[model samples]
Target chain A: MSVKQQELEKSWQQYKTQQRKKNLYYAFLTVLSVVVFLAIWEAVVRFQLVNVRHLPAPTVIFQTFIEKLHSTVPDGNTLGQNVIASLQVSLTGFFFAVLIGVPLGLLMGWFEPFDSFVRPLFELLRPVPPIAWIPVVVVFLGIGLKAKATIIFLTVFVSCVINSYAGIKLTSRTHINLMKTFGAGTWETFFKVGVPSAMPMVFTGLRVSIGSAWSTLVAAEMLAAKAGLGYMLQVGRGVGDARIVVLAMVTIAALGATLSALLNTLEAHTLKWKEMR
Target chain B: MENIAEKNIDTRPIKVEVKNLTKSFGDLLVLDNLNFNIRQNEFVCVVGPTGCGKTTFLNCLTRILEPTSGDLLINGESADPKKHNLSFVFQEPSIFPWATVEKNIACGLEVKRVPKDEIERRVDRILDLMGLRDVRKAYPKDLSVSTAQRVIIGRSFAMQPDLLLMDEPYGQMDIKMRYYLEDEVIRLWKELGSTVVFITHNIEEAVYLAERVLILSNKPAGIKEEVIIDLPHPRDITDPKFIEYRNYITDQIKWW
Candidate 1:
C-alpha cells in the first residue's frame, strides 16, 4: 500500500477505538448513576428518614413489581395484561392518527385554498388541551376503548399535523422551481418533492406525538379505564397501596422511554441523510 | 456594432428569443424592455452588477416570473415549461438532500417519465462526466460544496434539456473550484451540445466560458453591452487578449 493509504488506515483504526471507548464510558456512567440513585432511595427509607407507607423501600417496590407479573393486583389483572392493554390502545390510536394526519397536513400546507379552510378550525381546536377533551369524549363515546383511544388520537393528531404542515411550508422554493423546470405538475411535485422533503419533520412529529400519546393514554386510563397501568394506579390510590402506585408509575415511564427509543431508531434509519447527532 | 458580434457565427436556428420583456413588482420596475436572441447550441453568459435583476431575467425566460409586458419565445412559440424540456441550476445548491447523488441526477429524467433503462444510461453518463461515479450512493449532506454543486449541474445536464439556465451556480465556491467547474461546464456543453444561459456577477467567468457575454446595467436593468469572445478554448487568464476582453467588459460596467 502507498504511504497515504497506510496513514488513512491508521487514522480510521484510531477513530474507531476512540469511539468505542467513549461509548463504554457513557454506558458505565449511566449504570453507575442509576445504581447510586437506587442506593440512596433504599438507604433513606431503611433509616426511616421518610414514611415507608408514602415512599416504599426500593426492594419492596421491586418485590411487588415481580409479584404482580403473574399475580393479580387490586384491579384483578396481572401487570402484563395491563401493559398489553395500554400498548394496544396507544399504538392503535397513534397508527390511525399518523395515517390520516400526515397527508391532510401536507395538502393543507401545499394548497392555499385548503389551508384557508382548515387552518381556522385547526387553530380553534389547537389550544384546548387533549386532557380537557376527556369529559367530552366520555359523553360522546362513553367509558370504553374508543373513548381512551380517541383521547390519545387527539394528542397525537395535533402534533402530526403541525409538524407536517411546518415541514411543507418551509420547503425550499428553489426545489419547487427546479421541479417546475423538469415539467412536473402540481400533484407530482407535491408527492415527489414536497412529501419526501417533509419526511424529517413528519418523523419529528411522530416522535413528539408518541411521547404525548403515552402520557395521554395514562390520563385516559386513570379517568375511565377497566384495565391498564393507569387503572392499576387508580386502584392503588383508592386502596392506599403506595407500592402499586409507584410500580405503575415506573412501568409507564419505562414503556414510554422504550417506545420513544423505537421511534428514534426508525427516524435515524429514514433520515440517514441528516447529519448524525 | 451589435451586428459586428453577430457576424461569422454558425447559422444555427435561434433557440430563445426575448422581445421587449419588462417586469415590475408593484411600482418597482426590475427588467426594463429587454431583447435578446440565443442561437441553438450556443453558450451565452450574462453578467451585471449585484442585484441588477439577473435572476428576474432568467425567471422571466423560464416562466417562473411572468413579464408584465413582452414575450419570451422558444422556437417562435411562447415558452411553456410543460411543453419545453428545460433545466435550471439555481444560485444555491438545489440537489434533493433526501436522494443519493445518483438519484438526484436521475430525478429530472424520472419526472419526464423516461424509460428506466434510458434513465440509467443518462444518469451513468452524467455521473461519469461529473466525476461523481465513485460517490454515486452518497447523500448531498456527505459531499463537499463543490461536489454538491456538481451534482446539481449534473442533474440539469442529465435531463438533456433543450435550454439550460444556470444562475451563478458557483457563486459560493472559491476561485480555484469555480475555475475548475467552469472548465467542466465548457467541456459538458461541448459534449452535450445544449444551449446554456449562464448568469453570473463575475466578469472573468463570463469571458472564460461565454461565446458571447451579455452585460446588463443596474435596475431597472437592461442590456448595456454584448461582447463576442473570439478567444480559443482552454483560455489563459494571463493572455493579453483575454485580459483585454475582460477589461473591455469591466469598463462598460462602470455605472457606479
Candidate 2:
C-alpha cells in the first residue's frame, strides 16, 4: 500500500483499539463493584455486625442454594421443580399478553371507532393494580397456574397496550402524507408506515412488561402458590429459615435479569434498521 | 436560446389544470383564486415569498387539503391517487428511519401493488440514476442530507408517477449540494418525462431547473407572472441571459 493509505488504515485501527479498551474498562468496573459489595456482605455477617439470623453469610446462602437443588426439606418442592413451575405460568401469560396487546394497541391508535369502544373500560382497569384481582382470581380460577398467570398477564398487558398506543399515536404526519401520495389505504398505511415507526417504543414497552411479568409473578406466588420461588420464600418465612428466603430472592433476580438480557438481544436484532443516533 | 420561442408554438397535451383554485383557513385566505395549466412532461418551478401559500397550493392540487373552492384536474379528471399516479417529495426529511434505502425507494411501488419483478427492475434503474447503489442497504440515519434527498427523489420517480410534486426537497442543503442535486433532477425529469411542480423560494433554482417559472404574489397569493426560461441544457448560472431571468424574477418577488 502507498504510505498515505497505510497511515490512514493504521489510524483507523488505533481508533478501534481505543474503543475496545474503553468498553473493557467499563466491564471491569461493573464486576469490581459487585465483588466489593458481596465481600462487604460476607464480612458484615461473619463479624456479627448484622445478626446471622437476619443476614446470612454468602457461604451459608451458597450452601443452602446447593441443598435446595436436591432436597425439599423446608419447602414442599425442590428448587428445580419450583423454577419450572414458575416458568410455565409466567411464559404462558407473557406470550399471550404480547400476542393480544400489541395488535389491540396498534388498532386503537389508528381507528377512532375502536379506540372509543375499548378505551373507557381499559382506563378503568389501568387504575386498578393487578394484585387487586387476586381475591377475584382465587374465587374463579382457584389458586392454580391459571390464577397466577392471569395476574401476570394483567400486569404486563396494560403497559404493552399503553406503550403501543402511544407509539402508533406518535406516527409522523409527514410519513402518513408520503404514503397518501403513494395511494396507500388507511390500513395499508398503518401496517407499512405506522407499525414500523412505533417499534422502538413498542420494544420499550415490552422490556417494561417482561419486568412486570416477573415482579407480578412473585407477588401472586407469595400469596397463593404451592411451588415457585415466591412460594418457597413464604414457606421459609413461616418456618423461620433466612437462607431459603435469600436463595429464592437471588434466583428470582438472576432469572429476571437473564430474561431481560435475552429481550435486549431480540430488540437489537429486530431493530437493525433503526437509527443508532 | 431563441429557438425556445419557436419551441413555444409546439402543442403538448395539458396534464394539470388548476381551475380558479382557492384555499382558506377559516378567516385566513391563503390561496386566492389561483389558476394555471401545466403541459405533459413540463418542468414548472414556482417561486413565491416565504409562507405565500406555495405548499398550500401544492397540497390543494394533490387534494391533501380540501380546496376552499374550485377544482384540480389531471388529464381532464379530478386529481386522485387511484385515478392518476401521483407522488410528493416535500421539505420534510426522507426515508422511514426503520427502512433501508432500497426499501424506502421500493415503498411507492409496493403501495401501487406493482409486481415484485417490476418493482425490483425499476428500483435497480433508479438506484443507478440517483447514485444510491452503494448505500442501498444503509438506513437514512447513516446518510448525509444530500444523499437522503436523492433517496426521496428516487422513491418518487420509481413509481413513474403521472404527476410529481416537490416542495423544496433540497432546501436544507448547502449551495454546492443544491446546485448538484438540481442538475441531477433536470437529468431525471428528461429521462422520465413526468410532469413536475417544483416549489421553491430560491429564484435562481427556478431559473436553473424550470422550463416555465411561475412567480406567486404575497399571501392571499395568486400567480403573478409566468416567465419561460429559454436557456439550453447545462446552462451556466454565470451566463448573462441566465442572470437576467433570475434578476427579473427576483424583482417580481421583491415588488409583489
Candidate 3:
C-alpha cells in the first residue's frame, strides 16, 4: 500500500482503540456505582440501621425473592404473576395518559387562546397528587382494573401534559419565524414545527409519567386489586413477612427501572436527531 | 438586474411606502416617522448605528411587531402577502434544530401546499446551489454557522418571493465566509432577481451589497440620507469610489 494509505489505516486503528478505551472507562464507572450502592445497602441492613424485622438484609431479600418467584400459592399465582398484574395496570394507565395528555398538550402549545384557557385548569388540578384522587377514582370507576388504571392515569397525566407543552413552546422563535416567512398558516406551522420540536419533551414527560404510573400502582392496587405486587406487599404486611414486602418493593423498583430504560431506548431511537438522552 | 431596470419594471414602483412609521416601547421611541420607498426588485440596504431600528423596520415589514402608528404599504396597499409574497432571512441561522436542512428549506413550501415531489426537487436544487447538498440530510447542530445561514438564505430564496427582507443574515459569519456568502447572495439576486430589503450595521456590507444604501439616524430612527451606488455588478470593494462611499457613510453614521 502507499505510505499515505498506510498512515490513514494506522490513524483509524488508533482512533478506534481510543474510543474502545473511553467506553470501557465509562462502563467501569457505572459498575462501580452499582457496587457502592449494593455495599451501602448491605451495610445498612447488617448494622440494623432500620429494624431487620421491617427491612430484611439484601441476601435474605434475594433468597425470599427467589422463593416468591418459584413458590406457588393454592391459587398457583407466583411472584411473576403479581409483577405482570402491576405492570399491566401501570402500562394501561400510561397509555391512557399519553393518549389524553399529548393532544391536550399539543392544543395548549399550538394556540394561544387555548393555552391561556386550558393552562389554568391543568395547573389547578396538577398540584393535587395522584394518591389524593384515589377516593374520587374509586367512587367514579369502582373497585376494578379501570379504577386502578385511573389512579395511575392521574399520576402520569400532569407531568406528561406539562412536559409536552414545554417541549412545544420551547421550539426556537427562529423556527416559528421561519415557518411564518414561508407563508405557513398557523395550523401548518404547528404540525410542521411545534409538534416535532415538542416530541423530545413529550418523550421526557412519558418517561417521567411512566415512573409515576409504576409508583402509583401500589397505591392504586390498594383500592380493589386482587393480584398485583402492591397486593402482595399488603398481604405480606398482614402476615408480617418483611422479606416478602421488601421483595415486592424491589420488584416494583426493578419494573419501574426496566420499563423506563426501555422507553428511554425507544425515545432515543425515535428522536435520534434531537441528540437528547 | 440593474437598479433602473428594477425601478422601471416595478410600474407600481413603490412596493413599500413607510409613512410616519413611529414605534415606542412604553416611553422610548425606537422608530419615528421612518418614511421610505422601496421599489420591487431593488436591492436596498439600510445601515445604521446598533439598535437603530434596522431590525424593527424588517419586523414591521414582516408584521412580527405592530408599528405604534404608521402607514406601511406593500404594492401600494396594506402589507399582506396575498397581494405579494413576503419572505425574511433573519440574522441568526434560524434553521429548525429538529429538522434536516432539506426539511427546513421545505418548510415554506410545505406551508404553501406544494406537491411533495416538487418540494423535494426545489429543495435539492437550492441545497446544491448553496453547496449544502452533502449535509442536506443532517440536522442544524451538525452544520457550521455559514452552512446554517446558507440554509436559511436557501430557504428564503426557494420561496421565490417578490420582497425578500434580510436582517444581517451573515452577521455571525467570519469575514471570508461573509464575503463569499455576500457574493453568493449577489449571484442569487442576479439570477432570480428578487426585490431585497437588507438590514445591516456594517457600512462595508451596506456599500458592498446594495444598489442604494439608506442611512438611518439613531433611535426614534428615521432615514437621514440615501446614497445610490452607480457601480456595476461584482464591483471591487477596494476601488476608490467604494472606499470613498464607505468612509462617507462611516462619518455620517459616527455623528448620527
Candidate 4:
C-alpha cells in the first residue's frame, strides 16, 4: 500500500480500538456501580444497620415489584396496567400541551398584536407553578382523568410556549431577508424560514415538557384515582408499606428515563442537521 | 474603455436606473444622492473604501431599506421584490444550515412555487455548475467555506433571477479560493445571462470580474468614478493592462 493509505488505515484501526476500549470501560463501571449499590442496600437492611420499617432491603423491594407485575397490589391493578394508565394520562396531556403551546408561542413571538394580547396573561400565570393549580383544577374539574390531565398539561404547556417563542424571536435576520427577497409572502416566510429555524428550540421544549409531564404525574394522581403508578405510591404510603413505595418510586424513575430516551431519539432523527454542527 | 462603452450603447437596454438615491439613518447619512444606470446582463462591481455604505446601496436598490429621497427603477418601474424576480448573495455564508446543498439551491424556486420538474432541472444544473454535485446531500455545517458560499451563489442563480445582487460574497475567502469562485461566478453569469451587481472593496477582484466598475467615495458615499474594464474573459492579473485598470480603480478609492 502507499504510505498515505497505510497511515489512514493505521489511524482508522487506532480510532476503532480506542472506541471499543472506552465502551467496555464504561459498561464495566456501570455494572460494577449497580452491583455495589444493590449489595450495600441489601446488607444495610438485612443486618439492621437501618430500620427495615423505614428502608426495605433491595431483595424485598424486587420481590414486591415482581409480585405486583402479575398480581393486583394496592390499587386492584397489575403494575403493567398502572403504568399504562399513567402513560395514557401523561401522554394525552403532553400531546395537547405541545399542540396548543407551539403555535401559540410562534404567533406570540411573530405577530405584534398577538403578543400584546397574550403575553401579559402568559407572564402572570407563568410565575405561578403548575402544582399550585392542582387544588383549583381538582375543585372545578373533580377527581377524574380530566383534572389529572389538566394539571400535567399546565405543567408541560408553559415550557413549550417559552421555548417556542424564544426560538421564533431568535431567528437570524439574514434568513428572513433572504426569504423576503425571493418573493416569499409573510405566511410563506413563517412556514419556510421561521418554523424550520425554530425547530431546535421546539424540540428542546418537547424534551423539557415530557420531563415535566412525568414529574407532575404524582401530583396529578393525588386525587382519588383508581389505577396509576402514582396512585399506588399514595396507597403504599397510606398503609405504610415501604416495599410498595420503593417499588413505585423505582418504576416511576425507570419509566421517566425510558420516555425521555424515546423523545431524545425522535429529536435526533428530526434534527439530524444539527449533528453536522 | 471608450470603445467598449460605444459597443455597449448599441444593444444594451437599461436594466436598473437609480436617480438621486440617498439614504440616512437619522443624523448619520450613509448614501448621498447617488445616480447610476446599469445595462441589462451587465456585470457591474461597486467598490469603495471600508464602511463606505456599499451594502447600504445594495439594500436600498433591493428596497430592503428604502432610500430616503430617490427612486430606483427596474425596467422603467419602481423596484419591488414582491413583483420582481431578484436574489441576493450575502457577504456571510447564508446557506440555510438546516438544508442540504441541493435543497438550499432549490429554496428560491420552491418559494416561487415553480413546477417540480423545472425546479429539479434548475437545481441539478446549478449543482453541476457550482461543482457541488458530489456534496449536494451534505449540510452547510459539513462543507468547506468556499463550498458553502458556492451553495449560496448557486441558490441565487438557480432562481434565474432578472437581477442578482451580491454583497462581497467572497470577502472571507482566501486568495486562491476567491479566484476559483470568481471564475465559477463568471461562468455562471455567462451561462445564466442575468444582470449582476457585485459589491466589493477589492479593486483587483472588481477589475478581474466586472465589465464596469462603479467606484464610490468614502462615507456618505457617492459615485467617484466609473471605470470600464475592457479586459477579456479569464483575465491575467500579471497582464500589464489588467494591472493598469486595477491601479486606476485603486487610485479612485484611496481615502488617505
Tell me each candidate's i-RMS in Å. Answer: 0.9, 1.1, 2.0, 1.1
Per-residue lDDT over B122-178 for candidate 4, one digit per residue giving the tens place of the 0 to 100 score: 999998888889898998878888788888999999988889999999988999999
How well does candidate 4 score on lDDT at residue B96? 87
Model 4 ranges off by over 4 Å = A1-36, A46-48, B1-10
Query: lDDT tens digits, residues B1-256, model 2?
Result: 3455567673899998999999999999999998899999999999999999999988987777989999999989998876679999988885788889999999999989999999999999999999899899998888987788899998998889889999998888999999889989889999998889999998889999998999999999999988899888888999999998899889889954
Which residue pairs collide, candidate 2? none
Scanning candidate 4 chain A in windows of ten residues, the lowest lDDT window is A268-277
Give residue A250's error in model 3 in angstroms: 1.8
For every candidate, C-alpha RMSD to the true structure in Å? 1.7, 2.1, 3.8, 2.6
TM-score of chain A of each: 0.94, 0.94, 0.89, 0.89
TM-score of 4: 0.94
What fraction of the true interface does each of the listed models get right, in terms of native contacts kept? Answer: 0.78, 0.69, 0.59, 0.71
Best model number under TM-score: 1
True contacts kept of 1: 0.78
- Model 4 lDDT per residue over A30-94, tens place: 88998999899999988899999999998888888889989886678899999998999999999
Supply the global lDDT for candidate 4.
0.90
What is candidate 2's CA lDDT for residue A115?
Answer: 100
Writing each residue's lDDT as its tens digit, candidate 1 over B1-256 gives: 3555667666899999989999999999999999999999999999999999999999988888889999988888998888888999999779899999999999989889999999999999999999999999999889998899999999999988889999999888999999899999999999999999999999999999998999999999999978899888989989998998899999999777
Docking quality tier of candidate 2?
A: medium
Off by over 4 Å in 1: A1-7, B1-7
Candidate 2 lDDT over residue span A76-121, tens digit each: 8999999998888889889889999998999999999999999999
